[model samples]
Target chain A: MANKIFLVIQREYLARVKKRSFLLATLITPLIFPTILGLFLWVGMSDTVGENRKVIEVVDENNSFFLESNELYSFSYSELGQEDAKLLVQEGLRFGFLYIPKLDIQNPKGIVFYSEETPPISMITNLEASLQSKMESLRLQASGIDPLLLSAFKTNVDIQSIIVSEAGGERISNSVVNYAIGFLAGILIYTFIFVYGNQVMQGVIEEKSSRIIEILVSSLKPFQLMMGKIIGIGAVGLTQFLIWILLIGLVSSLVMGYFGMKMPQQQMLEMSAQQGLFPADGNPEIVEILQMIQGLDFVQITLTFLIYFVGGYLLYGAFFAAIGAAVDSPSDAQQFMFPVTIPLLVAYMGLFIFVLDDPNSNVSFWLSIIPFTSPVAMMGRVSFGVPWHHLALSISLLVAGFLSTAWLAGKIYRIGILVHGSKVNYKVLWKWLKQN
Target chain B: MEILSIRSLNKSYGSHVALKDFDLSVSKGKIFGLLGPNGAGKTTLIRIVNQIIDKDSGEIYINGQALKMDHVRNIGYLPEERGLYKGMKVKEQLLYFAQIKGLRKQDAKQKITNWLEKLNLSQWKDKKIQDLSKGMAQKVQFIATVIHRPDLLILDEPFSGFDPVNAEIIKNEILELRNQGVTIVLSTHRMESVELLCDEIAMINRSKKILDGTIQTIKEEAKTNVFRVKMIPDSMEYVPMGEELRRQDGMLEFKLELKDQKPNELLGMLMSKGEILGFEEIVPSIEEIFIQKINESHGE
Candidate 1:
């Protein structure tokens, strides 16, 4: 019996793996994110392709202030009227023209930027900052206060978040990193179950609709067939997922290397260090980030993920298989699919709302413990640190849930696989379930 | 030796009784026809034997041993609604089924090649089932069914989707397999094929077996003892020692009461009246017997 199931699994796996669609999907899926990211970065960087400098015509009616020019924008002070400067911009000669009317330094008004197109906010802010600083230093001089002393007193403060463990070890915790990891893991589980679980369903439906189930069931039991197909397709999903992870990591690094762009982690570390958030002795933030990652209990989370991934898939996969057997065609499956997918949808929503927002909340706890939702929801909670007892209880319940669902679905599948040309409903399925 | 035996088998779906007290015994190397009208529980009986479904109450024995899951390895079933994986190549599909039936990988590969060649489907081995013509696919399904060299083969309406030429080829293959000591249980509504092949038969109607026996024995038991006799052109209108049923083409047909007199004595009496041109006893076909038995049971 076990050998037969293995043969079925082998057939299922080999058939899917050999398909062009599977190969295309598996190969392209990992490249999609990186390729899109690279495309966007290319587009963003190419925006600097035009004239290397911006020529801003400054018309200061006060005639007492002089503006400086930088590499990005060159200031052209002119006694010419504002109307003439606007014409130069309209004729595409100047990038933009700034008109600063004479005003009280205490309360400036009617300070307008006149141009054919709206100037970028950064250019406008630079102009405003330059003028404001000059005005401030003049005011300090008039009040007999030293401008250099006041400038020396200015300081930028940085707040650091450090997690002090019970073991007297300090680790920096980045909320953005935690949120990203949890979110991605949760979504991955959700997508895996949805995508691969449907593959299991479609496989069963294909076998059933094509009448191959008749030959299949004659040699092997229906439960064995169901389990074999579920496991087979689940393995396919896992293979694709692992490949995607490895390929995405490899491809992104290669692309970044080609462009001489630093890794995002290194960039973040360098930026924080330049801001004096970390001491120059050693990059403690990088070390702390790594420690915090290690302290997240990935071994437990990953092991639970695999267990729940299979468990949730089996639990839902049995019903999907049963649904496949019960219907005559793919369209007929729609009516039965709603109820089967409800728990998965709920788990997905709960992951975003309850688990992500507050992983230790009662809603998250209940959702994670329930077998149908646990596969996704528990992964969400695991990244945020799940209690050992909750993880144990959830895994145990998921196993039990799979067995019972398998039993129930086996009954329906046994009868449904043989029957054709009738509109089977819940009543008929109930009757089948009760039969020997 | 009996290859398969079932006693007092019963099965039901919900409140609908599909089979009641069904008993059958198929001897080795013989074609056993399971005859029934639509919804007459033929599929139910076949499924029970194949272990595709469970029996509520019964005992089934294969080679004098109680039926077990492992026995499926020794039995091949081609269901009425038969098909192969449409997206799978013929060779791979056949090999998969062979392995599922407990053949080793090398053995399955060998058997697949042999069956493909034997069925004249070697060229189509690498082609997907969807690409094959309906008749060609049917041939592939037949090969898949028998590739494992099962001891007992059960086919339900195996010829439903085949053309006459393909049907003849399959019929010949079935006979060839039977010649190799394979016990075959054929369930179909095509009585002509039944007549051409079946050594013994059991007719089912409304969830019960109404009649069963060798084809000849059932015909003999249901005979009216009628005979057709043709006389010379110039002959007396002499009557035999029986009731005259009809006269056609210079032939005289009559029904005799064998209870009172022997067939030899009746022939002697007829010989004295006219030159015996033709004399033959008429036997009922299985089709007629089936309809009669079913009508009888329905009436009861």
Candidate 2:
């Protein structure tokens, strides 16, 4: 029996691996992530490379005050009249020409500026302020008023955030890591269920509808067949996913190294900004994200995530395999699949809401501990510092749930594989489970 | 000893009965034909024997012991429905099925090679099933069914796609297996093949066994008391036997119904007439018997 099952697994692996579609899908899949990332980067950087925007002309007609130098903006004297300067600016001779027109000895209102496009508001405001300050200082010196009072009014300060734990112990904030952990956890759970669950369903449908499953189940027990299919397909999925991760990592490093781009550091900083995307207000989400990333019980979270991912995949994959066996065609499988999938989907939606509101809430904790929902919920709690004991409890519960659901699904699979020539409704399926 | 005996089997699909009180027995080395028309529950009985499906109420004995799960290993079944995995190579599929039938890897490989060579499938062993033609695939399916050299072979429509030459080859192989003491339950609608091949037959129609016996006995049971008499001209018009007579193509042709009359009476009449060209008793073919039995049962 074991050898038969091994042969089945081998057949499943080789058959799928040899297909043109599978090869294309697997090999082409990794290229997609990097290609999409590169395209996005290309579109964003297309307009900015090797282009400088700050150009300024300083009149300095009387050399009353030499224009203070700046790196971003260049200073040049206006050699032409205002109209000619305006034409020069329009014709790309310069960004703009600044003329310190003949001013009244005290009022200083006669200044001219000319440009095609409007200058950046910050640059325009800064230039205007600086010009005014120089003029005022010059006027003040001429009028003989003291500048000592204004110098005494200036001071600068930087603030840091601190958080107090439940026991009133203060710690430096790690908000960015917390949110990063949550986001990564949620994304991983979502991806595993979707990818592996669909694979199980497609495998079952292919075998069942093609009428080869009867031959398969004859050699291996139904449960053996189901388990082997799930494991084999899961292995294929994991292999493909790991390959994708490696390829993306390789391409990203190459792109970053060759282009002299600092994407990883930028990504870390952007992770902090991503708290805004989560919509937490005045809560120091950056510190929370960082703390979650750093202070998370790594061993507990890793074990729990692995357990939940495999458990959730098996729990859903059983039903997917059952659906595959129960229906005669893919279209028919779709009808049955929706009802089974919705719970997982609802768990996901609930996890999203729970994570955003209270990542460690009772609802999130209980749901994550349930095998079907654990993949999403436990990952959510991992982002919010789940205790080791609770994580262990959740993993245990998921395992229990996985085993029971597998039993139920195997019952259905046994009956559904032999049934043909009729539509199997929920009621009929329920009866088949009881009788078979 | 009989290799398989399905005694009074009964089965149903929901309320629509597929098999009712169907009995089949195959002696150790005989090729047993299971003749039936479409929807005659031949497949249902075959499945039950294979343990692929269950018989609601019956006892199936294999090798003089009641059939059990382990008995499945002794019976090789080729279902009418094609069961090969289309994506798998022919050799891989053959080996996989051989393992399912309880062959060790080394044995399965050796046997698979032997069967592949025997069936002239050596070149196509590495080709996927989907790449083969229907006949080629059928040959592969045939090899899969018998690769383990099972004691009892249950083949449903085994010759479905084969042309005469290929069919003859398969028929010879089946006979060879039978010669080696494999009891075969061959199901098909092809009565000609049944007549040429089967020693005993049990036929079902409308979920009931309509006939069961050795081919010779069933043909005798279905025989009408008629004999054809052929003679050159100058025959007596009257005869002691029942009358059904006609002449054509410069010969006298007539049917003598011998209800309680001896066949020699017809010979006597022909001999009394002009020199008898030919005279013989006509035995009904299995084909005619099947048609007649079904028509009589249906009142068609």
Candidate 3:
């Protein structure tokens, strides 16, 4: 049986890897192709649009405004008349003409911008903010009050969160960091499960449509075939992911090297700071953020992620295979998708609503403990920090859930692969399950 | 020796019985034709033997041993809805099937090459099955079925999609395999092929074995001992105790039942009444027997 499964796995792996779409998707999917395309686009755009900064000619009636200039746009205050500024813009000497006719401060009106194209909203909004503040200060001055006192009332407040571990060590922790890790790990599991799970589905459909299921089963059990396919496609998914990481890393670094752009060397900077070569103490928040990141238990997080990643895929992939077997085509598989997706949707929503915000909440506890939702919901809680019992309970339940689902799915798959129908529903699926 | 045997195998889906109290024994080296009307549970029986599905309550033995997973390698089944992976090269697909059935890669490749060449498909081995004609693809499927050289081969409608020339080639190959001491169970509705190739046949109808025996025995069982005699009678008025079928210019054709009479005695009695032109026994074809048996079982 093992040998037969290995043969099946070998065939499935080779068949998919040989397709042109696999290579194309691997190269284009993970930011590598787009990044290279962006590199060329950046180079091309720099020659035309980057070199010429947009210059706006301001014709202020009061001549009291001092407009600031930036790299993408420049402000030119001209004593020239409105008509002359419009003429300058029409003559292509300026990108736009901003005419601010004497504003009645209380009711500012008749401010217009004339350009060949519509001015960006950012440019208009920036101008409005600057002019509004200026008018407010002018109003304050007319009232015989110092605007500096209002500015003195404004101060910056930074709230640094500190967490006291059970071991009695208090450290400044960043929720942003925790959220990032949890979100990344959770979404990765979600994406990998769907992508690879669909691969297993499509593979089953292919075999069924081609009428190879019966012949295959004659040589080995249907369960073995389904498993071989799942494992084989999962291996391919892992292979593609690793290749994307390697290729994207290699190509992006090469491009960055060519342009003499250095990545944020946080580790190098921290090393220098520790060696007293560079004083990162200037930014206390940065030091604390770095330390908090290092303080995270990546070993535990990574281990759980791996366990659930495979576990989640197996759990959902079995259902996907059964669905594929039950339907005649990919389009026909839609009716069966809703039920399978419910648990995933609940887990996804639950991850944000409960797991991330309050991992220890009862709702979060239930979501993590349930096998269907735990693969994703548990990841968020794990990243925050979970009691060992919760982890053990969830993992154990997930295994039981997977075994039962696999058994159920195998029964359906054996019959469904041979069943040809125009319509299949939950009733038919139930009948098939009872057939066992 | 019986290489394949099924005793009182019973299988059903819900209230619908597929196979019930089915019994069959195929000798070591012969093609046993499984004849049945559409939806008569022939495929179900074959599936049970292949263990693709389980029998509700019965026993199936391959080579005098209870059927088990290890017996998979001993059986090569060509399902009615047979197919090769369309996007897969013929050689690659064959190798996969062969290796999965427990053949080493080198030996499988060798056998695949020989089968492909023998089937006039050597030039098409590198092409994907979709690229080949239907007949060419069928040839490839046939090779895959027998590449492992299984002891018992169960083929369901193996000739359904093949053209005459290819079907003949396949028939010859099946015969060749039988000559090599392989037991084959062939399920098809084509009665002429059954008559031409089958050594023994089992007729399944309405989830039951209605008739079964050697091709000759079944045909003989359904025989009427009737003969088609063509003669030039001495006198048209002296008609015998036989139905006149036709009169073709001095030839009197009629059907005569030679029940319990020796061929010589019947010939002697007929010779005196007419100068016998032709005297031939009327035997029922398997097709006729099949239709008759099915209609009898259906009570129509």
Which candidate number has the best lDDT?
A: 3
Number of the predicted model whose DockQ against the real structure is largest: 1
Model 1 chain A worst lDDT run, 10 consecutive residues: A286-295
lDDT of 3 by residue, A363-382 (tens): 99999999999999988887
The most accurate candidate by TM-score is 3
lDDT of each: 0.84, 0.75, 0.87
| TM-score on alpha carbons, each prediction | 0.84, 0.77, 0.86
Error of 2 at A203 (Å): 2.8
Runs in model 3 deviating more than 4 A are A31-157, A167-172, A258-260, A265-278, A281-288, A349-369, A378-387
Segments of candidate 1 deviating more than 4 angstroms: A47-159, A164-170, A264-298, B233-259
Candidate 3 DockQ category?
Answer: medium
DockQ rank order: 1, 3, 2
Pitting candidate 1 against candidate 3, the one with the higher DockQ is 1
Task: Tell me the deviation in Å of residue A329 in model 3.
Answer: 1.3
Tens digits of per-residue lDDT, candidate 1, A203-312, equal 98888878889888888998899989988888888788788889998999888877789676666567566864544565666645654664566687678778877788
